[model samples]
Target: MSDGPTDLPAPREAPDAGPYWQAAREDRLVMQNCYGCGTYRFFPSLLCPECGSEEQVWGPCSGRGTIYSLTTVHRAPSPAFRKIVPYTVALIELEEGPRMMTNIVGEGRNEAAIGDAVEVCFEARGTDAKVPQFKLAGA
Candidate 1:
């Protein structure tokens, strides 16, 4: 019914995610780029995945991608997501080039397909709380 720790939300971002959030607040999808290896990264980390470099910078993304894979959750530990049973969560491969796992909102759960093109959208839960999500491309 649950994949991991549904009792808690995904790990909260460290203060280092500030720039990424700032870009999101402006409707921009920003990822991290390693200065040492020139690789695009996501989820905000201080080190490069390709290399062990600690120098990174924010990079803008195209907000276009295809669903690399997905899963529909039948149950949610939190009552808030109870009404959203069967919601699809996907791993998107961005055209600007990085894969980020996020929920696919505002679309029929059965509509998500592997390799289906999608676009970025933001769901703001509160005045200061927002999350990046995906939807059927051009939908």
Candidate 2:
């Protein structure tokens, strides 16, 4: 069986998020860092929220985090996800400080709890893209 849903819709690539997606395809995790203020931000904004600086860089992430919060979906929101009902979605607090929403996959996903350690993994989204997901640390 698949570790997570294979038929889920692909993520739309925003112009500023291109690097993040490309990095995912290469099996690496990255986040936007503001050069002006030395702050990291997610969702890949063009301007740094802290210092309002347009200068930014894509930096590597540790790919390690703790589950800040989570939920188990007992019902699929769409037919494509029906086959994967009962999947877990979690808000992961990355070691670098930003939190990201992603699916918790692989072993122990359903039993995942807040504060559980997790590490990044990639799930193919299509021919050219991959989505970052998480699994229990060491699982």
Per-residue lDDT value at 101 in model 1: 94
Q: State, as a TM-score between 0 and 1, how close model 1 is to the true structure.
A: 0.84
Error of 2 at 23 (Å): 0.5
- Top-lDDT candidate index: 2
Q: Report the C-alpha lDDT of model 2 over 73-99, residue by residue, as the tens digit.
A: 888888867877877889999998899
lDDT of 1 by residue, 7-84 (tens): 323335469898777776677888888989888987677798789799887888888999999988888767767756
In angstroms, how far off is 10's CA in candidate 2?
1.8
- Please, what is the TM-score per model? 0.84, 0.94
**CA lDDT for candidate 2:** 0.88
lDDT of 2 at 109: 79
The window of 10 residues in a row where model 2 has the poorest summed lDDT is 1-10
